[model samples]
Target: MTTELETQIAKYQKWRENLRVTLEAYQAWLEGHGHADIQRSLRIYDLVESLKSDRVILAFLGEFSRGKTELINAIFFSGYKQRLLPSDIGRTTMCPTEIFHDPSDEPYVRLLPIETRKSEESIGSLKDKPVEWVTIKLEVDSQEEMAKAMASLAEVKVVDVDEADKLNLLNDSEFVTTTVIKQSSGKVEIPCWRHALINFPHPLLKNGIVILDTPGLNALGTEPELTLSMIPSAHAVMFLLGLDSGVTKSDLEIWQQYIRDSVSRRIAVLNKVDLAWDELKDDAEINASVERQLDETATTLELSREHVIALSAQKALVARIRGDTALLAKSGIETFERMIADEIIPAKQQILRAAVAREIGGMLESSMASVRSQFEATTNELKSMSTLGDKNRDLAKKLLAKFEEDKARYGRHMESFNT
Candidate 1:
């Protein structure tokens, strides 16, 4: 049986062989017939080769019950509910969890245990049971991963540790580790986690900067050792709350310290407000109470009341899929979307502005996202739009670099190859 490492090396070799074949075929064709700009073709090949190496990581964050995982799946997985992080009512995450990219036939999470190698041969049946840690593999992909990761989406994991309740990690747990290669594929190490959080980057997240999915302040202390380590280094803090509950006493306490005390971006999302829509008769008492809560929450966080958006994460996800901006507004998700498109993108682009010297980065920034397509068509040198015979690439390419730089400081692994 081929080792995983050997398989990976083989894959790399296959890619190289494919490259050689294509080059030989092209060169042969150009030998007899007149071909235009052979140097240009080589440069195009080089760019195509180089572009594959570019990758960014990101993380998602929120409180334990705030439906944070659900939102992550809906947005990042292209509205596909099958792929998500596992979430439920009874504290599912027992350790700090991480997810990294792995493109293969059978998807799996390499559950890495800090203490011991698990004796249980099967990874599909190790959840709920008390064990130290085990590097179990989950047969999942991005979309399927999202479904398993969040509550909003659900699918039958051919094998699920949670339902199996057959294994457990005993003590020390190091849940996440990942390495990117030239093809932008790498090994992602994951472990059995509970109470902790998920703070790693993916393709969607700028750079390798992971937007943290935190365990609301109340629950952070469970893994007391790593909480302070992770929280203090994050780029921004977002407090996800339920609209029906508004800002409860516990939520206020958490905001006052962990989220509000810091000096980066802070946002509060009023989720599940769809529940209140029918009850609130335009200007009813319940509606007024919600408004009051929004104001107070904003004041507590030193943000404008407008920053506290009352939207259904679910509805906003739907609107995004259908490209129904009007429904998004009606569903109240437009505010959240604006945060991603206008604020977050603009800010990150400002930071990554320098990487535009690279073609891939430039195209990513100038015309990468769906929303920006319309704007790029209007053509302006300042905006960096390009139109060639067959390719039209224009985008702001700076956000990835900035995001990666920011995220690296927070538990990025470095190999001592130089030594």
Candidate 2:
């Protein structure tokens, strides 16, 4: 009863595991034979670890209320048979969040305080300081509990405007709201945290897949890491937009400003197709409308129709939960999921293969040069030792002949002097 998605996931998992083991053995062999240079060995080791740890990072980028989270839940978490991420109407993911799995760590939600942004520290460096982040242990057995814990990503803490500004969370009061506590107190405010990192035990994530669910342009613009590190390194980036809005000014700005230059494979998603579905009378009308939007969106983004996909993430989630195959097919998630599994994942595997080949090839070349140098030096020494007796005899004969010639010349000089 495994779906194509599940089958592909399993296949990738097997491939990675096999690759890791094979590389580990090769590294051991090279180490034992003393053929591995430190630098080359380290590079090979790092590639092996990367192959083991690297996730097929699928980053979902869009503005608020564009169904970015809903799309994520539909594509990744529908197996829970309910909404895993907080995708309600008003709630928004205020900061950049990365959902991934590290088998070494426990399942928890780690929120980096906005105050830490005042200092010069990357998120990676700050991960070890448990006191600076708020950690919440997750009950992986229950989907509802995990859902409640994940809802905290949208939670805001009330702080003075000055404090919010100092934390760099306040940007012209757009992300925060002004409030009055009482007659005595003046204005109060709530500031969203800077960023969120959630570690979980999801199957896809455990198989080395990371999902970057980014919302709001303001947050994306503020987080330089998103543009410089996360987005650029991701294997795939999906820009989600609603069909009703087509390509809005904000969407265009986000695309042109940040996403357009990304090296990752790009896809323009026209989500919330269910809204467009309701007005159509028949199948023909539905197909015509869907095709029209697809064409229009592709034109707006200056991409081909193949790169533009239209789907209803909400309906897809519902269909998945209810086990409605027909509805799931109509949701268009299967087509997109298939594209990811068959095309993107396989392509990533090929990329990894090339990287492995390059790293191992370098290591082998270095080792071969060292081995050849040692063999040539040893060969010259052995040849010199093997000819040592012959060389000594030849030197004696030459020295004897030179001595007889010098004696004959000395006798002639003495006789001439006597005469």
Using TM-score as the measure, the top candidate is 2
Evaluated at residue 35, the lDDT of candidate 2 is 57
Error of 2 at 128 (Å): 3.1
Error of 1 at 5 (Å): 35
Candidate 2 — what's its lDDT? 0.77
Per-residue lDDT tens digits for candidate 1, residues 1-419, read 22232233334434445544544444443332233255645654665454343322223444457766556544554344332555556344434444434342133333334223225332224333435333334433455543444431211122232222222321233321111001123322222334222323334332333444544443354333334555555544557787767677766766665656643566688777767766436647657766777787677657877677766766656666676778666776545655654554445444333342453343324322422443333323323322232243222334334434433422121111101
Off by over 4 Å in 1: 1-63, 99-108, 112-209, 283-289, 317-327, 352-419
> Per model, how many backbone clashes are there?
61, 1
Off by over 4 Å in 2: 31-34, 37-40, 172-191, 365-419
Residue 133 lDDT in candidate 2:
90
Q: Write the per-residue lDDT of candidate 2 for residues 1-419, one digit (tens) a residue.
A: 35577679779889988888877766775676565678767877798878777778889997678888998898778888898887877437766789999888899988887777799998777877888898889898888889888888777656665665565554555432221111214334443566788998877787777898886675676667778888888898899888888899878988888788885588888999888776537878887888899999899888878989999999999998999999999999888888888888998989988888877776656655655565565555545544556667776566556655555554443333222
Model 1 residue 146 lDDT score: 37
lDDT of 1 at 19: 44
